[model samples]
Target: MKDFIKVMKALSDPNRVKVIKMLQQREMCVCEMQEALGIAQPTVSKHLKILEDAGLVQSRKEGLWVNYRLSGGGSPYAASLLGNLKHWIETDPEIIALREYIPGLQRELVRKKQASPAETQKKDSSAAQDAATERRETHD
Candidate 1:
């Protein structure tokens, strides 16, 4: 019963439902989901966490990204819902639009755009150091 309620609660939000719909298509990182759903990264992550806790999704570590896919099933409720979801919402305009938008979401480009200010600054510093090193080598 608790599992049933948790799954229900997890799916209560439209964004979360859209997430399940997106995962049904392919595995995606949070950045990709954010771009597709037009939501914040942290919000997307929160949605993933809820979905994971409800056994609606699973994740794997791939290099720097954690990719999420629809879970095979943890409980009967989750499995039943996952199965039903495949046949549902396939025709809604928003769902159709989302599916089309997803393919265009380049994870690498999204990640680059999502880089923190500190990370960007560090990258800039690294590039400057590389230029200085090149100049010094040329002078020698």
Candidate 2:
């Protein structure tokens, strides 16, 4: 009963609900969530802390960065709560707004993922092309 009340209390906040809905798509860093939700980092962290305390969110640290996602708790009650949240937010207008931010967020994530290979290749190519143009200009 006490756990149930805590879970309910966590879900009662609209910001927390939005954060959960966002997590349904992908794990996110606090910075990305701040951009998507148009909220300050501290506010996002607060919401995340509430969700974490309720067992609705799980987080892991990668070096200095911590990423958060929906927690797949072993408890049946926690699972049911997560399911209900999924169903409720999927149909809500606020959650729909989250969809608008998703594409940009996904693109950013992809860009980050692609950076290691893409960065050097792109910079080298650009430099080479600039050098070629300079050579051509001098020759002309």
* Tens-digit lDDT track of model 1 for 62-104: 9988999999888999999999999998998989999999988
lDDT of 2 by residue, 26-84 (tens): 88888788878888779999999988988889999987678899999525566797887
- The number of clashing residue pairs in each candidate reads 0, 0
Return the TM-score for each candidate structure.
0.87, 0.70
Whole-model lDDT values for every prediction: 0.93, 0.81
Most lDDT-accurate candidate? 1
Q: Write down the worst ten-residue block by lDDT for model 2.
A: 106-115
